[model samples]
Target: MTKDLFGRHRAVLPDWLALYYEDPLEITHGEGRHVWDAAGNKYLDFFGGILTTMTAHALPEVTKAVSEQAGRIIHSSTLYLNRPMVELAERVAHVSGIPDARVFFTTSGTEANDTALLLATAHRRSNTILAMRNSYHGRSFSAVGITGNRGWSPTSLTPLQTLYVHGGVRTRGPYAHLDDRAFIDACVADLEDLLGHTRAPAALIAEPVQGVGGFTSPPDGLYAAFREVLHERGILWIADEVQTGWGRTGEHFWGWQAHGRSGPPDIVTFAKGIGNGMSIGGVIARAEIMNCLDANSISTFGGTQVTMAAGLANLSYLLEHDLQGNARRVGGLLIERLRGVAAQVPHVREVRGRGLMIGVELTRPGTDEAAPEAASTVLEEARAGGLLIGKGGGHSTSVLRIAPPMSLTVAEAEEGAAILDRALRSI
Candidate 1:
């Protein structure tokens, strides 16, 4: 049955849509932090559907909220007052740390970022945009324009003029050998140089951590320094927090807080995780920028009743249980455990990340060349050992991405780590 379904999926889906493993397992159901394949074999979930499942699977609060909302009313569009949407927006704005923040809901991170780009270009009257190298924003035409990773970005034609910046990854860039302060200074200098050669860009968009580029991050305070320069030139900073939002990073509620010295960005885009499993995404911006458009617009399905209800319930559960704190504690231990395991593996290049968003980059022993085959081996072996993980990286897809639900328990972490340890040793 699984083989038949896999064949059918390949027949219907785009070829570019990649799947993991040599033989993909069809996930039949999930509960807590575990999922079962069609063959009735269960595996501990580490990727959480690419970090979309923030809380545990089948969380009662979220299920109840979805069921209740669906029974009441599912779709009304944005024509009328949406109580749940308003409530969720208020909560998100309060937590977003942006002053006079206005929220606009969308169906996905791509749409959220598209809306942000629209706002930024309209407000600043420029089409040029600055983005960090090794960043993945989304897959839409507008979002893809700003994406800096070559593998994920397939098109050269783009509506916006995008200029790639330096310093998204600290491990293998031109300034890799420099100290943290020196690296930040070098990136800032590069940004200054780029600005000198082109028209002032509408905004500078960046991820606090480059997710699909292998959970890599710049030196702390790097963006803060760049913000100082952008602020003087009236350039908006857009923080793409699709994968790093909702306290996944542990120390900060939002990933951009790692560079908090410069205060909040002018605009922020978020999706994944916040809705639990619901399709919810949105952009938060200052009122002036959000209101820049003269004509009216509305997303026919954005801020629908059902998704908002799920979002409200899921968010309430996240805050009430303090899952962020749990991510910090459990994720810290998990990283330490993986680091210890990686220490014994010659092919493991580096173990990096914060909270549950950890990455183990694979490389040829004693060389900088990426070992993507080694990553695939570890992924398959770990799955065979009753663990499900993910692989990602711009440089040949050689990074093992491990981001479990924020509600992950210490025992589960230990179990997953042990399985991963064996998988790494096998590789």
Candidate 2:
């Protein structure tokens, strides 16, 4: 059955679309933190569908809300008033931290980011953008153009003139040898130098925790320092929170809070995890920036009744349960366990991240050479042991990404870590 499905998929789907594992398993269904394959094999879900399942699999509140809303209506274009959409927007605006925030919903992170680009370019009257090195924004033409990661970017032709900046990867760049303070200072100085060489940019967009760039990030307060510089130049700051939003990081409600010493960002984009599995993405900005477009615009299926209902329900459940606090407690334990495991493995280059979003980079034993094969071996071993994980990096995808549901229990963390420890040992 699996072979037949694979054949059919290959015949129809785009070849560029990537899948995990030597033999990709078809996940049939899930509950809480576990999922069953088509062959009746069950495994613990750690990647959470690329971290989209923020709360849990088959969460009751989101399930019920989706069902009831579907019974009433699935969509009614953006022409009419949408109560659920309005409610979700209001909630997002209130929590966005941006004063006088206005929300615009989309169906995916790509579209949300595209909308942000439109706002920034139109408002600032500049097509230039500042994007961090080793960043992956999305797959859209405009997004790919701004992305600095070569593996993910298929074309250099873009609608915007993008300048790659330093500081995304803390340990692999020219400033890797510097301490935290010097690293931040060198990056800030680079930004200042880069700006002097180019025309004034519309905005500087970045991920607080770069999801596809091996879950890497600059030191805390780095962005705040950059914010100070950008503000002096009248540039807007856009935070792409698609993966780092909704308390996944544990220490703060939003990833940008780690750099909030300056102030709130001018705009924020979010998707993945907010709706638990529902297709929900959105952009929140100050009313002035959000309204800069004089012409009319609307998304055919964005903020439809059903997705909004699911998002609203999921958000409520997350807040009521204090999943952020749970993430803080359980994620800390999981990281410590994984750190201990890494110490025993020669190929484990670095273990980093915050809260539930952790990464384990693999390198050739006793060297800096990225060990993509070692990562693959550990991944296969973990799957055989009934555990699921993910891999990503700029250097041949040698980093293991572990992001379980924010509501993960301590026992589940221990169980997942044990399986991972054995998998790493097998390598």
Candidate 3:
């Protein structure tokens, strides 16, 4: 492929655009778990387009559905109802076990999250929101405000008094000194104290499995406890399953199920794998909460025909094949293999997460310190060896996030792990 002429000193690119620090590669094509760069170099996609693409690239069924829908009707204004829209919403509600829930679709995760927040605030007539430290909602202003990552922006804080909950600590790497149980207790205490001292919050949002926050799965019964506390105060629980939803975590159709929680969330936002690769997102909220807001309050493009078709196709494929079962089996094998690799590689501090949503945290020699440099080196070497992964977390950038498609086979899992093991050895 020709060198991009757009990489010049004089360009009309927007000044606000901040490219990812890594050198960009021009990907020309993709298939299941693999993509070819413009130069024809193939890379195994363990990252799965940042943990989206649940079924894989150019899936025949999904493509056929999109094609047929495109041919029939691509766009329908909100003034009229569409079949795909109604069908997808019904399917999602059925699968999620929230029969009375209603869906408000959007084109991306951020928009979905933003809509949820708006609805929550409007319904409760409350100004404050609660979120977990290291949780990632989205990039939009309201969503980013609740995101606890300090890396977002120096001034990016919640407009309301956002309460940051502490679930656990690294105990090694970036959070070496922080204790997990103690931190959780402190957080719970803080929440109780705040509730007793002040007015109730509009909502308390959390990722069932914190994605950008090191893929940390909180202690058992933690989410249930959170739900209990929030419900007591008449506050809504919003599960931001942007990364953990759509059967990626295995053991269940949703990550909240993996938490062993009993009650359902008042509001659940989904994106990423919902449309497989096509852009679509939505909020599934309790009928009561949904009814509090006027229909005219939200604008157009919330439920376009093309996105609804893709979402329907994606959900149908997942259900028909029982891909969640695949995620459980393959994810179990992946964790076992990764743990074995961790035993051999001293730099590997911990292997955490459920099912396909996994993170390998790295540490430095002699000290229980995060080796960001080593993590970067391993990522670079892995890319050189034709494997693709991502780095995330608070301080370390030491978490190697592995979230492949739900359809990734056992053989593919083994091969990907072996290649990653080789890359770790080099580090």
Candidate 4:
């Protein structure tokens, strides 16, 4: 049955779309952190559908909200005033931290980032953008144009003049050998130098924790340093929090808080996890920036009643349960466990990240060369051991990405760690 479904998927789905295991796993249902395959085999879910399941699977609040909203209305286009949309927007704006914040909804992160780009370029009167070295914003043309990672970017031809900036990844670059403070200084210096040689850029957009780039991030204060330089030149700062927002990072409610020494970002784009598996992405900015467009804009499917209701319920549950604090405590323990395991595994190069989002980079035994094949092996082994994980990175995709639901328990963390230990040993 699984083989037949896999064949059907490959026959129709895009060839570029990658699957996880040698034999693809089909999930039929899930509850809490566990999911069942079509064969009725249960597995602990650590990746959470690429971290979109913010709270947990089969979360009652979100399901009830979605069901009630769906019974009444699922979508009515942006032409009408949606009560749930307005309520969700109000809640998002309050938590956004931007002064006089306004919200614009979209169906996905790509559209959210696209709207941000439109606003930034129109407000600054330039199409040039500054992005981090190994960033992955979204898959749209505009979002992909600013992405600096080649593995995710397929084409270089784009309308936006983007300058790839240093300082996103702190482990493998020229400044990797430096201490945290010196590394921040070097990246800032490079940014200042880049500005001198280019046209006036509209904004510097970046992922606080690069999701597709192996969940990597720079020092906590690196973006604060960059903010100082960009603010001086009237350039905007757009935080792509699709993977790191709503307290998933544990340290802060938003990943930008780690770099908020100056202030909140000028524009913030968020997606995954907000709706707890429902499709909801949004951009938040101050009125001046959000209203820069001379003409009106609307997303027909964005902020439809059903999606907004799900987002509202998910956000409420997450905040009410203090999941951010849970993430901080649980994630700290999980990282320590993984670090101890990695110390004994030569192929495990590094373990980094905060909150629930963690990365274990695999490399050749004695060298810095990425071991993509090893990553694949570990993933397959983890699955065989009744656990589901994820893989990603900039260099041939060798990083083990582990982002469990924010509601993860200490026992589940221990169980997942044990499984990972066996998987790495199998490597």
Candidate 5:
């Protein structure tokens, strides 16, 4: 059944849509942190459906909320006021930290970011954008314009002008050998130089932690320093928290708070996990900027009743159970275990990231050459060992990405780490 479905998917879906594993998988059902495939094989889920399952698989609270909301009403569009939508917006704004925050909902992260770009350009009257290198925003035309990852970028044609910046990755760059303070200083200097040379950009968008670029990260407070410069010039700052938001990073509710010296970003776009698989995304901005557009705008299916209900329930559960703390405790142990195993493996070049978002970058022994084949081998081996993981990286996709649900347990972490250890050894 899985093989037939895989064949059908390839025949109909876009070729660019990639799938994992050699045999592929069809998940039939899930409970807690585990999922059963079509063949009735249970596996520890480490990817969490690309981190969209923020809470857990089949969380009862979210499920009940969605079912109840769906039974009453599902779609009313943005033409009318939605109680659940307004409720979720109030909750998100209260936590977003933007001054006089206003929330705009969208169906996905791509659209949420599109809305942010529109707001920035309209507010500042400039089309130029500054984005960090090795970043992946989305797949939309406007989003691809700002994307710095070459593999994910499909074309160069875009409506907006985009300039790439450095400092997203600290491992392999011109300033990799520098200390943390020096590195931040150099990056700030580079930003200053870029601004002096180019037309004034509308805003600078970045992921506090580069998600699709193999979970790479910059030094703490790098963006706070950048914020100091941009704020002086009236340039807006947009934090793409699609992957790092809602306490996934463990230390802060929003990833941008890692650079919290300057307060929150001008605009923040989030998705991936907020709805707990219900397909909800939105943008938050200061009311002044959010109201800058002359014409009205609305996402046709943005804040529907069912999805908002799921989001509200999921968010309540996240805070009530303190999943952020759980992520910190379990993810710390998981990273330590993986690092210990990587120490014995020659191909493991670096283990990086924080909290539940961890990355293991592979390279050829004694060289910096990326080993994508090694990553694939480890992925297949892990699946064979009853563990499901993910792979991502801009430089040849050689980084193993491990971002599980925030509710991950220590026992599951240990089991997944053991499987990864054996897989790395096998390769």
Candidate 6:
């Protein structure tokens, strides 16, 4: 019955309510690439609030925009047009390179994903959806149903019309090396086999870079091939960019663009970093697909005036500062450093992912929870050394996930890497 530092009522909460019980460090404030606890202890933030603070926390531009909008107008029903909403939608479409894209706003990534799911089912007149195994869409009923992780499965998921595709198959042992071509072929084959028995799905949804799935990148030509197959089957290809969008992947404003494909997806969803820590999520859909959706099926708080203002400010920052370029440069250094660290540590099994979204897989050295323990130890030790990191993947809390803000500097990257190195050595 330990009480929180604030003297709030605290008890042994259930796992569902453990998020509140966990004594998260009280971050009093943040700036640039660092956050401070209530005690004024500065910590280098590598996790970047799970990659939501793209432009950095307390960004002056974003803060001003939000403040101004709040002072003037905060909420405007989706029925009425807001200037910021319209401008933000235009910017998202322009950056996505998707012509005639219709935007539908939501309060969070889960809501946006839920809307996308509904649109898919309604447009194609099919209930089935194809999603990548190990993928994490969200926590809502529909979003969770489509999520590939079994740990997120609810008691009644059997009734949902969802199918899973093994994006990356393990051919070696636990630390298997993946052959890109073979993996893509297997995925296509799996989909084909499923289609033979079940009805053609409404859409095939996937994260461009599998975020929670160990930050794994798909095989080359895989996205193009997947789109072709879906088109042939008269199904939509919905790229769930909730985690990979907004310059986090570098090389492109959106991760789908990094696929090096000319044809855009039928629908692309975005959330993290869209408002630079403010609550906002949106879906950009091709005109044809959008036209099919009922206009009345929008969210009440979808395009709040404040959220729109934050989105616009965030987008402006990204475009003006060329944060995407910085992401590429800094991300290259990060990958190199991670690879070097892996080479030095035998327990470090693999280093995977693209750009700033990185994952370090640990092997079972001697402990029963070797991989997970190593990851936890690294995170704890990093925190003690003035850095905050996150965890994800197989064990529901194992893989060391590092997805920093796009605005992070090279020096910060070096410092975070050094902290990681020290943590590994200590562990």
* Alpha-carbon runs more than 4 Å astray in model 1: none
| Number of backbone collisions per candidate | 0, 0, 0, 0, 0, 0
Instruction: Give the alpha-carbon lDDT of every model.
Output: 0.95, 0.94, 0.80, 0.95, 0.94, 0.79
lDDT of 2 at 153: 97
Tell me the TM-score of each prediction against the true structure. 0.99, 0.99, 0.93, 0.99, 0.99, 0.93
Q: Which ten contiguous residues of candidate 3 have the minimum total lDDT?
A: 1-10
lDDT of 3: 0.80
Q: What is the C-alpha RMSD of each candidate to the true structure, in Å?
A: 0.7, 0.6, 2.6, 0.7, 0.7, 2.7
| Model 2 agreement with the true structure over 107-212: per-residue lDDT tens digits | 9898889999999999999999999999988989999999888899999899899998999999998999999999999999999999999999999999999888
lDDT for position 19 in model 2: 84
Q: What TM-score would candidate 1 get against the native?
A: 0.99
Write one digit per residue (lDDT tens) for candidate 4, span 1-427: 9999999999999999988898999999999999999999999999999999989999999999999999998999999999999999999999999999999999899999999999999999999999998899889988889988899898998889999999989898899999999999999999999999998899999999899999889999999999999999999999999999999999899999999999999999999899999999999999999998998777899999999999999999999999999999999999999999999999999999999999999999999999999999999999999999999998879999999999999999999999999999998
Model 6, position 12, has a per-residue lDDT of 42
Runs in model 4 deviating more than 4 A are none
- Predicted structure 2, TM vs. truth: 0.99
Better of 3 and 4 by TM-score: 4
> What are the clashing pairs of model 4?
none
What is the Å distance of residue 202 in model 4 from its true position? Answer: 0.3
- The residue pairs in collision within model 1 are none
3 or 6, which is superior by lDDT?
3
